[model samples]
Target: MKQTWFERAIFFSWYCGIRDCAYCFMSTQPDSKKAVRSKESLLAELLLCKKLGWKIGFISGGIGAFSQTKFKDLLKDMYKVSGEKFWLNIGALTADELKEYLPYTKGVVGSIETVNERIHDKICPSKPMEPYFEMFEDVSKLGLKNAMTIILGLGETIKDFAELKNIVEKYNITKVHFYGLNPQKGTVFEKSDPPSAEYQAEWIKKTREEFPKIDIQCGIWVDRVDRVAKLLKAGANSISKFPILKKFGSKEAKEIERQAKLAGREFRGTLTKLPEIDWDGEISKLDLAEELKEKIKNKLRLYLKKMQKNYF
Candidate 1:
């Protein structure tokens, strides 16, 4: 029996200090305290991931809680030893923080979780949705790619979906990660029902329809193969995790890879390839989409004019 190497990896260096959101799996609360992993522990994990040839890494932390100094130090350490590409989800960064962090990162991400500002404020009381948008614009201007996670069943309506579409178009978010709500036992949402798999699949279809060019990472919260197939069929190009490839064994890994390919997405480990979120490229896609729409409108107008003349 041989072990498999993961091409991509999603390793959380720390539980989000920003546990303000009710759906957080780690349940990081406002008063919740978490010990920062010692620099040695973090280095060891990164080294192992690098040694295993993990191509993509998602380094995440709770909003406003992880030390920027420590994160920069970790980035410096990885650069010295490995060239594996990476993205950071160190919640609600300031523009200056984004600027400082850009050179060391392939991309940076934060979760608005929902487009409804009221829901966002209620779910993440310590942070506002405004700053995330501000930081996204700032990051884009820096020519760094940005991504956002949208958690469904978090008090959002179809109207919010329209807003989410607007945000994607307005900011040119290169990638969108869809997380089906998983209510953690100790959190505010613990008593709330999880979003139906059907609900998630429907939204996945809507998202794909609205933003055909934006890369979508779907079913990070799903574990069942049947539902995964549903999500993939609904337009999810990627599943969130296949960590078992690195930790468990081959049988399940082969199945996940097979299903991913069947869904028209490659099992490229955890994160979408760093280059997939090319900020400029995505903005160009928006431009092209708009351009094509206008061209269609123009053709329709000419056809209508010809029809009117013939009828007269």
Candidate 2:
């Protein structure tokens, strides 16, 4: 299969949902200082990313503090402003709810961390697996694209891989996003370690061999940046959740470009890199109320400032 690399910009709309999944940082670090971006700010950022030529946009977070009507309105407003559809990873939506989102949704992303029932129940006690499965089935029947995210090193065994394969085939899933478990500081798995590079590569290779036509993406977080070349060779056609290496002018960004060339693939898109924009000019042009526009401008300024200081 031909190899190509692209970046996806995920915008967080809300955080700290009601579910207290053991592995989620939102659940473990409720008092953390990080603030959730307002829905208006999220819309402005999505529009800016679109203006910057990003082809894919994802709206991610828990279904926290949003009434059914409000969530639907948010989606409707996002599409109306950006004139683009976005994939959603908020949480499992019922079939009826899926229908409500279909008009503005490009696809649905499921967080099926593991197929091992025992580990899943223990790790994600509040999040039942059945809804995710049923959601995928509904997504398929609705004729929309669907993807699943799986976390490695979550006490999953080789046997779980077979189950994963069956699930993928059963749901006609076209994409699989593989993430190495990043033990959050306050989570139950805080002291645990992510899967080794070799372990990640092996499973990715097996996945490639098993599903030749499937789109496979390996996440490139801070700790796993060095594993890029091996993972590309292991058959990952795309990288997701990568840091904004370009903004720092780091050698790692150059190295990633060099490696992509060495592997004969085209690497495209910006990973969390905000482009230079006339904030005042952009905000003025938005078709939003003046108050909301000012809020978005302020939010964008703060966001850019934060990104300048942070690496991940």
Candidate 3:
């Protein structure tokens, strides 16, 4: 069967959230300083992504200190600026919150890191597992699509795979994003190792064989670039969070491209397609306040400068 190939452009609105998930890289304690990006910066990034013809825009990351009202306003601004529906992966929202965000949201992503309640409780003690499942049900009932992110190598057992199947089926999930737990230095899992490429591939293949139509996306980090072809062959139709490939012009990126072709798939948009544009000139023309416009342009200028010096 033919597969759809695309790389989603994700916008990190903030870095830290309220939850103290053990596996999270961000500071989640009460006194943790939230590195929330300005509204202008987020709008700037979204606008640039829209101009680049990337179809999907995800407001991803931890639920920072944003109130419901503030988040809703941000969503309104995002929709107004881009004139495109976006997805949210900022943790679970209540039924009412989901409804409020329904207009601007194309879907909601639930981070079901692990299906085992014991492991989940131990690893992400502050994050409730049931809420995510509840949110998925709410998202489905609201007529919006729902997806999930699952992390492997969290001491999850083979029995968890059966539970995963049940959850996907019960929630009417359309997509499942698999990530090999990239242990951070200070996190609880710091001394632990990530799942092997083969282990991840086996589960992905099982998912594909069971649910032939579901979209399976594998998150490819810098260390696992070589696993691209293996994952593609296993059943992942798309790759996620792999910006280094396009941004850095590395030989590994070239090799991944070769592997994708070998598996008879094409990476559409952000993965392999970055158009050259006049950043300052184009951002200046956007319908935004002068101060905001300058902010966006300056941010882009710095990013471009870094990219040019180090990668391009």
Q: Please, what is the TM-score per model?
A: 0.72, 0.85, 0.88
lDDT tens per residue, model 3, 1-312: 354354555655445555567877663345556567777767766765666544453677557657778888888877877887877888888899988888899898888888888898888877887889889888888899888888988999666788989988999989889988888877778899889899999989999998999988888777787888899999998776666424544665555666677777765544433477877887777767788788888777665554454344
Clashes in each model (backbone N, CA, C under 3 Å)?
3, 0, 0
Expressed as tens digits, the lDDT of each residue in 1-312 for candidate 2 is 255554565655445565477777777655534345577677666665565444453677656646667778887867766787877887888889889888888788888888888998898887888898899888888888888888998888666788888888988888888888888888878999889888888878988999998888887676667788788889888776755523432456556656666767765644434577787787788667789878778877765665565344
| Candidate 3: stretches off by over 4 Å | 1-19, 27-31, 51-57, 243-247, 270-274, 310-312
- Which candidate's TM-score is highest? 3
Winner on TM-score between 2 and 3 is 3
Q: How accurate locally, in lDDT, is each candidate?
A: 0.61, 0.73, 0.75
- Order of candidate numbers by TM-score, starting with the best: 3, 2, 1
lDDT score for residue 200 of model 1: 83
Across residues 82-125, which tens digit of lDDT does each residue of candidate 1 receive?
45446777776787887677667777776778888888888878
Q: Kindly give the stretch of ten consecutive residues in candidate 3 with the minimal lDDT sum.
A: 303-312
